[model samples]
Target: MTTDPRTLIWSKSSYSGNGGSCVEWAPAQTTTGIVPVRDSKNPDGPVLSVPTRSFAEFIAGVKSGAFFAA
Candidate 1:
């Protein structure tokens, strides 16, 4: 089933802090095993739909600082 991006609720992490560089995701999308992600600064921009498992791995990487530069 196709879902409308505008109809889904998007939210960012609390750790996003004061920076406007955060991304938002629609938890409601998880019902279909798809995670919808989009830039908070560009709500009208393109949306990325990632598999639920892939999204979870990405989050794990973020928590582990795998993407951080030494």
Candidate 2:
């Protein structure tokens, strides 16, 4: 399901901080149970869409520091 990222509403995480490395996601698209994600620095770049359950799991991993480098 290819879509123009510009057409969807995007939101950056409050934890994104001042660092330039950040991602934006279209929460509004969750109505379809799929979330579209893209780099905040590159709005015109490619978008990655994932299932809502997968997105939730990813967020849980982030919160649990599962992605942090040991």
lDDT of 2 by residue, 1-70 (tens): 5656788989997667676678899999988889998888888888899999999999999999889745
**TM per candidate:** 0.86, 0.86
11-60 per-residue lDDT for model 1 (tens digits) = 99665657656789999889899999988878888999999999999999
Q: Which stretches of candidate 1 lie over 4 Å from their true place?
A: none
Model 1 backbone overlap count: 0
Clashing pairs in 2: none
